[model samples]
Target: MAAKWQVVREMDANLIDTALVEAAYANPALRALFPLVSHGSLQFSRCTRFPWSQDLPSIFPYDGERHFRVRRLHEPRGSGREQIGGAVTADEAVELVASHLPPGCGPALDGTPDDLESLS
Candidate 1:
């Protein structure tokens, strides 16, 4: 059986993550991307389906407390994420992420790039 403390810890994480996701969705810009909650981090992607690009940015709770960190995902492993900025609330964090979105990025594509290509 799972330990009680572990279960509680997971529940707490979920609550924090859910709140972050809700805040992200409230923004029209983020409502289109696929949102994911990992531990206390909130990550966004440009595709709703699988095989998401790892180059997108992620929002993490940082500064040893309630502060949020918006960062860019780095590839090739161990390169370290690029810090976008810090926010004190979920709304502020969402705004930071939304403001840094890729140029001309619209609502997330419905599927993989290949799926989009075939439509051309």
Candidate 2:
């Protein structure tokens, strides 16, 4: 069975939402990984349905400016949560989200070749 896992971190809600949307638009695969995106006054979430379980994979970003907490919701028998990483910028938060995607879900890049190359 797939390991029930979650990646959590904290960052600006708006920043995370925009990053998730932009990433999905840039990479169609991510659309499958994160089909639903929602935002509230205090938090933002991106979620996708999984075949193994009824509960979908969820990514949540808590409100903050320089430093924030983000959490990945997992259903390991029951509702569970984990902290995977944190970020100082929206880009970093997005990278963390991409890196922690459930098994089988591949990497996601939201920048041009030059931009990606520079990071390498």
Candidate 3:
């Protein structure tokens, strides 16, 4: 089957219900994918890539399963870029935000470009 990629515009703090944070974190896939959701979230048009191939919304509906809506983003890629985001747990929020920082340019920040961790 063909892959489906969702270009996430922003991380809706409101859409993220507190009750399901732990469940999301428990799943290894969800934890690994949270970072991508946080990337380039400074602006709406920034486009944070996410994975929505597995009927995630139907399986793990947010909030009331009908009220919660994750704004689906447009992908310029011919088919898809690949699903990269998911329901972020509360504890992962801090780390999630930090991982999406702008890239470094000065020497004081860190070593070579290869050593940098920020996504830019």
Candidate 4:
């Protein structure tokens, strides 16, 4: 899981989309979650299929099936508090997202080559 994640971090949008599409085709859980990610949309949204007006950072719709909605949000600028359940906090939530950290992203949000190295 980490390997794929790291490799994709260094990729461009086209590559990322292709990689995600391939992964979704193979993994049902990923299939449901991958598409809803808006292209180049920095702002987070709930991972729900049904729209509900709420100020939540994002939502991940989960069903009994292996496939479900899952979103990964990034932390704020220079904030030690990591994102927990899409909210900034010291404690780790069930999940966290590395948002807007694609290739050519800002230094603060960019995925470093070291991140890939560490995973290796």
Q: Pick the candidate with the highest lDDT.
A: 1
TM per candidate = 0.70, 0.44, 0.25, 0.24
lDDT of 4 at 74: 39
Tell how far residue 4 is off in model 2, in angstroms: 26
RMSD of each: 7.2, 12.8, 13.4, 15.4
User: Mind sharing the TM-score for model 4?
Assistant: 0.24
**Cα lDDT tens digits for candidate 4, 2-106:** 343344444565423433334433432322231233342212222222341122233332332222233433342222322334332211111223332233322
Quickly count the clashes in candidate 1.
Answer: 0
For all candidates in order, the CA lDDT equals 0.66, 0.40, 0.29, 0.31
Which model, 2 or 3, shows the larger lDDT?
Answer: 2
* Candidate 1 structure quality by residue, lDDT tens digits, 1-120: 113223323456545555666677677777766666667787766655666545567899876466788888566224589888875677788888889887756466768655644755
True lDDT of residue 74, candidate 2: 64
Worst 10 residues of 1 by lDDT: 1-10
Best by TM-score: 1
Instruction: Assess the local accuracy of residue 56 in candidate 1 as a C-alpha lDDT between 0 and 100.
Output: 66
- Residue range 7-59, candidate 3, lDDT tens digits: 22223545443333433344343433322223212111122232222111111
The regions of model 4 sitting more than 4 angstroms off are 1-16, 32-34, 40-120
Clashes of each: 0, 9, 3, 7
lDDT of the structure predicted as candidate 3? 0.29
Local distance difference test, candidate 4: 0.31
